[model samples]
Target: MKIWYCFTPLITYVADTPEELIIACATMNSLPVTIATCGDFGDPIQHPPCDGSSTLANITAIITSILPSDLIVFFKACKHYNLNGVNLPFWRNWFAANPSSFLIPELLHHLHKMFWDHDHLWCTTVVGSQEIDFRFVLLQVWTDHHNVQWYIIGVIAGAAPTDFISAIRALMEFKYLTEAPHFTKKQVVHLDCCLKVFHWLKQSIVDTGAWWGKGGGDKPWAIPKLELLQGVVPSIYSHGTVMQWSTDPTEHVHIRVVKEPSRAGNNHNYDAQVCRHLDRRDKVECFDLILQIYDPTLMKMTVDKAAGNFSLPDLCPAVSDHLN
Candidate 1:
């Protein structure tokens, strides 16, 4: 007989920090970096007013430019950016890894969240939430990638202006392409084309006053996740696909291991209580596995008895006689 333990579920407690720190860690160069500042995009610091003269060539130049932070100059830049309350984080010395490359495409936040948060709002503004919801109800489809792929055109076609519909369709195409299980070289080029089309047509949303600007005018597409779209194809080529490193499983783990366990504990000193609860749960599971390996009947009977609601007397009149 042979037994193999394939996976051991465990949680590593990592202290959460602000977005700035994460960007700093990923790039290793720290911000006011090209990606964060839109410096590569020919946009000034803080994404100043759109000069309309910003040509396609200027826009096309926007690309991911992560430089090595190990350089002497970058150390000063890290300090300037106030990363980690130190000149450089300690992990950089020990972990010789490019996290920025690995940290490429997280589908949950990168796509789904961006869709709901920004894109959905722009869409609602363009074609009114009431009309969109009415269409969705008529289609009997939930809001998801499938909703976008199959029925989005019908949902928004007549309600939205032609350019707005086209822009959304391009974005939807790009989203589905990015989520494909595998991609050929040709598909990658198609992905790029979809993105380009979306970018070019997205100005229509601004033109229609759908997307409001911070300074009280229509804003250009300066969102981080939208910019992150540029790196999706590169990430696919470097890694297998977005599915390989999707954050969905991680989010599931958070709910099962973190949130559920925390709820089991009393509010006071719950962290240690949760840890103890998980350890006990793991031990009980392991013990059950051992029992099942040795004698499957024992484990099966234990589970049945544990799950059984009625006593022996309820099952047998003879048992009641014995008790009496």
Candidate 2:
């Protein structure tokens, strides 16, 4: 009888003594693949800085490790190998927070919940928000969240940095107004930086020139800055903040809860849609990458079903490496 057979290779390595994550790539490269190994990971292995280990870093490394057509990472996250990991307490607390209860999350959620924007980039021939010829628009995330709005401003790149004197001078031209106060200064910005963005509401001013502003002129009252976070991609900026902390190398904390029906049925597919990147066409599928400082003392991810335990470092090498 003619039979069809399959042989699945195991591309696995463990880093017990994690440094800057040099060992993982070194192993994957220095070692040779038997018939069991996959050839997608080329001769030269390139990676960002790593503080030994992290969840997101592992996830990204495996994703880019394969060829264009391979579906290993998908199958691993979706089925085969269970993720069995979670963020530290700080990150978990951050997920449950909103603008009203923001400060603590900064303390809880890995010191930062930065949003890395893979959309609205200049390199994609994508026009600036205002310059769009089409009448594209969006709905509010929540009506009650009053100050949640995008502020428009001009940005000039490749210029030198501005000192305190230049900053005040620029503000003079765009003089502040003394209008009747409807909202307090706190409502204008929800930053927990301890480094205040502005002093008052009527004179609500934002630091538009900082490297975070992406060269755009900002107002003290702009709801979301949309430029604080940075990425390796040039001309591309993210709209979020970051944090620092440590989780126990042994324990685990859960944040992403996929229901049974979701995991076994169509729910997973639905999630794949909603969490899709703003520019799905870029081949940058999802924004599942969650960065946090590598802390072996906080919490970790577990199967939560039977007997399974894993750290974020066991998964995300790319993101973890970069963030650290």
TM-score for candidate 1, residues paired by index: 0.66
Q: What is the TM-score of each candidate against the true structure?
A: 0.66, 0.17
- Cand. 2 TM to true fold: 0.17
lDDT of 1: 0.58
Weakest ten-residue segment in model 1 by summed lDDT: 9-18
What are the root-mean-square deviations of the candidates from the true structure over C-alphas? Answer: 11.0, 26.6
Per-candidate local distance difference test: 0.58, 0.25
Summarize candidate 1's per-residue lDDT along 279-313 as a digit string, tens digits: 99899898768656755554332123565533332
Sum up the clashes in candidate 2.
Answer: 42
Model 2, 110-151: lDDT tens digits are 111111121122211223345332222233233221211121
- Model 2 CA deviation exceeding 4 Å by range: 1-127, 130-256, 259-263, 267-324
Per-model clash counts, in order, read 0, 42
Candidate 1 Cα deviation (angstroms), residue 130:
2.3
